[model samples]
Target: MRGNRGAHRGSPDSGSVTDVVVVGGGQAGLAVGYHLRRQGLDFVILDAEAGPGGAWQHMWASLRLFSPADHSSLPGRLMPIQSGHTYPDAAHVVDYLADYEKRYDLPVQHGTRAEAVHRDGDRLLVEADSGAWRAKAVISAAGTWSRPFVPALPGRGVFAGRQLHTVNYRRPADFAGQRVIVVGGGNSGAQIAADLALDGDVDVTWTTQRPPRFLADDIDGRALFDAATARRRALDAGRDDTGGVASLGDIVAVPPVREARDSGRLKASPMFERLDRDGVRWADGTRASADAVIWCTGFRPALTHLAPLGLRGRRGHITTVGTRAADEPRLHLLGYGDWTGPASATLIGVGRPARDAAREIADLLDA
Candidate 1:
């Protein structure tokens, strides 16, 4: 049941009290926690993960970061330069995140998944399967990895071949020597297609609704974040925004992907019109048999835990001023993407918005 109507802090009877309750324990959540601690706020990070690393642990084995370790990091700690890795792999990121938790000694409630957030006066109550948390502010940093998106293409159900989303994909050797269709336009699609292409045994048909956007070889997460930051600054200064990541493209041409693309082994095909019992069909009725389809379509914000608040607008987007929900100022959203802040989803990019959100929350709590 709802607790109160105005912006007065609530003294809920059943939950642990804190100044802030961060609803995720991933990169974004960690960033927010770091800033909140700096502000000296009493807070706890509710992480659904049993361990650390957030969603990085679930990525494909060969997945690499878009930037080098130095450029890809959260707020305080610089990710140690991995001895031999040019671009840190998923494992390395996991290690860094785990260490980050220990380094700061951030109070994180691991294995706790937030169930919902309801307003009780000005305070927010975060309901979790493990327990309940009552705080003056709630920062929802739940990232998108849990909610993989696969398009509902025509005849998808009839396709006899194996179909899986990115969550289900781990490595390419699993689909060895089979015809596989990888669908998506962004990095995941490109990377997975390249992964399959490198296998040599797999016949990979990479399809995207639009042509894949490939950033230049030199471009990495650092450049993208910097450009995005500049763009954000320009926009905030009331200047006309121009070239940034959009002009570059979505997919980063990491070495492996470059190898696959340059050699033509990872050539992208136009999206298939529909799935057939045994394969895919094109608009011209052209058909090709496929043994499997891997959808790298991407994901939506993992905000189901915040559903009780009734803050989402059309298409589940929560309108916000920075990270604060427009309709519910006590609730802030971080790291979902551009909607929260420029490049907020990336490790390097999450800092600014996290800092901003923490500062605002601190100010509100002080008031």
Candidate 2:
């Protein structure tokens, strides 16, 4: 703590007392590790998952990245081209991440879930299931996948049929022969609904609070991330800020989604007001029967591990400057979403902010 990145392997009981301890060994964590290794900081990455891949391993089977393999890689490495596919699917991503970790040899302790972070004298203590580590700086890359969010809709409890989220969905066959209502306007909602419509025997309805927004077919994660970068540059330079990715649209028309839309199978209805025991009712005196409701509503940050720091605002977000927590300079949050950095949630975009966070930590520790 006193001498900066003068880090060494530590006492047996307390784990490694390193210059930095990074939480979550996903794309963001690995990205941070790449830059931190460049800085030659002695650091360890703690990952909750049992192996490489992070949240990608748990995603629904039909999930696919909007960009091709070359366009959707982390820093210092290109994801090997997945053969026989234009867009990489979740399984391909898992394999790429596994290989990336091996190639870089980043120090990641898999299966170690961080429980809490507490200040200890001049250093910060990260307590995890495997052991505790005291470090000069801590980077919370613990991503949002563990914290899937669902709205508190009225009469939701009484719904008799299954209620699930995108996390619970695997493939279309799981919902075959059922009336499935997919909620939310985001990509997951669209993808899941389309999955059922195109691949399964399920009768599916897509619902959004407002009309769904789909980007032009040519637009993918690569183009969207570039737009986000340009918007951030304009804002930083005090120019009339151009719009970010949201201005483009919500859904990126990956092939299956494109097919569903072009075939008129992916039609979105207005969101229902409340749920009955076996169905949902619209505010407009309309009712429909449903076998199940899947809420693809998205997630909140998995920052409960950092709760002891007392930094989150009323809305459960840590106020950030660049990637560093505004209230706690020793702490940096990455990969939660745009709040941490524009497009940082995307596979390609997280690298820039991860690089920035690593540099800031290196400088802070050197100070």
Regions of candidate 2 where Cα sits further than 4 Å from its true position: 1-12
Specify the poorest-scoring 10-residue window by lDDT in model 2: 1-10
The prediction achieving the highest TM-score against the true structure is: 2
lDDT of 1 by residue, 1-367 (tens): 2212112223333667777888889899898888887887878788899999899989899999999998998988999998888899999999999999888887777888888888888688888887777788899998998898887899999999999998888998899879999999889899999999998989999999988889888988888998888888888889998666897798999999999999989888899999989999999999889999998888999989888888788888999988899988788999999889999999999999999998998788767
Candidate 2 per-residue lDDT, tens place, 85-144, comes to 889999999998998888888888888899999999888999888778988899999989
Q: What TM-score does each of the candidates earn?
A: 0.95, 0.96
lDDT of each: 0.87, 0.89
Clashes of each: 1, 0
TM-score of 2: 0.96
Q: Assess the local accuracy of residue 310 in candidate 1 as a C-alpha lDDT between 0 and 100.
A: 86
**lDDT for residue 322 in candidate 2, whole number 0-100:** 93
Tell me the lDDT of candidate 1. Answer: 0.87
